[model samples]
Target: MKIGLYFGTFNPVHVGHLIIANHFAEYSDLDKIWMVITPHNPFKKKKTLLDNHHRYQLVLEAVEEYPAIEASTIEFNLPQPNYTSNTLAHLKEKYPQHEFCLIMGEDNLRTLHKWKNYEVILKHHDIYVYPRIADSEDQTQHELLNNERIHIIEAPVVEISSTAIRKAIKAGKNCRPLLPQSVWRYIDEMNFYK
Candidate 1:
């Protein structure tokens, strides 16, 4: 089984995320996409982030209707200060039978060099990159990305961000259309942003 790891904080799961994940699952060669919900780092206390479980719950609700898309809480069990390289290594060890690939935006590819053990990530796993606004500026591709392993997937450019959604909710805006119906209800009932 080939799986694409779509990593995000998912502070509150929204429609844009579903769009991208669904796009990957439907368009790409990946058999399934795991919306890997990144856990809150204890050292980096982000007041905006809901509890890991709450965030995971939102992701669960958001992906419940999509068979090809599923929510994963893998990061919650990993050691703190986890990096992408660390997660990749752990996943390979745990699921040796399944081939893992990375699903990222082109913007992340531009900054990929800065990540810990980025070379290792490039060496071991294939990267499936989607278009991003920042990707338009870099006409010349980086030398490092000149490899067969990197797949530039022309997925939809999702402009909606979780931060924007949170701000809208905090401002008492009707962000229902921006999120999955179930997630909207959860956020509303819990009074998360308000």
Candidate 2:
């Protein structure tokens, strides 16, 4: 089976996330999409993120209805400050039979060169890139585009972000429409981001 690994902190899984993952499942050749929840991202500050377990739970609720998409907590057990290259290596060892691919947005594609062992990753697995509205002016053309493994998918450009959702919740705004019903209820009941 060809599985696409969609990595994210999922501060709280929202509708935008579901749309993108679903789009990959429906639009790409990927047989399954794993929403890999990272315990800690090297680039993100922890203070704004919910606990790893809570984020995992939110993902579980967010994706439970979709058969092709599943929530994954694999990174939760690995050593802290998760790196995509390391996670991919561990996944290959754990599930050798299945073919794994990376799913990312256009914005992430811009900075792929800076990632640890990015060259190795590009050489080994296919990368499925989706459209993302860039928040800043980054005009450099990624040389990685020359690689045969990078497939640019014509998916919808989702502008919603987890950061905006968290800020809205903290401000006492009802952002339920931006999230899955179950995820919204879970966040509301747990009083997260308040």
Candidate 3:
């Protein structure tokens, strides 16, 4: 089995996340796309993040109808500041039968060098990078671009962002179009981001 890991904080699962995962499941060689919910990202601030369980549930609700995508809480059990390379190593060791690939946006490619064991990640796993609206041309022209392990996929570009959604919710605005119905209902019922 081939799995593509779409790792993120997913503070609140939105349409954009679903779109990319769907595209990978349909267009890429991946049999399934797992949205690995990272409890804590070393580079991101923890204060702005929602609870891991709540965020995980939101992802589950958002992808419930889509069999091709799954919500993984793999990072929840791991140590703080969950590193991609560490998670990748653990997954590879546990599921040796499955071929694991990393799915990320082109913007992250620019900062790949900042990640822990980034070189080892590039060498071992195949990466599928989707386009980001604000990604610079120079950022995409990294040395890894020539590596066969890295693939640039033309997935749909969604302008919607989790920060925008959170702001909308705090302002008491309707953001249903930017999120799945289930997720929107959950956020509304729980009064999240208020």
Q: In model 1, how many backbone clashes occur?
A: 0
The weakest ten consecutive residues by lDDT in model 2 span 137-146
Candidate 1 vs candidate 3: the lDDT winner is 3
User: Model 1: runs farther than 4 Å from truth?
Assistant: 41-45, 135-141
Q: Note the Cα lDDT for every prediction shown.
A: 0.88, 0.91, 0.91
Error of 2 at 159 (Å): 0.6
Which candidate's TM-score is highest?
A: 3
Model 2 pairs in collision: none
lDDT of 2: 0.91
Measured with C-alpha atoms, the lDDT of residue 123 in candidate 1 is 92
Model 1 clashing residue pairs (backbone): none
Ranking of candidates on lDDT, top first: 2, 3, 1
| Tens digits of per-residue lDDT for model 2, 107-184 | 899998889999899889999999877777454435677689999999988889899999999899989899999999
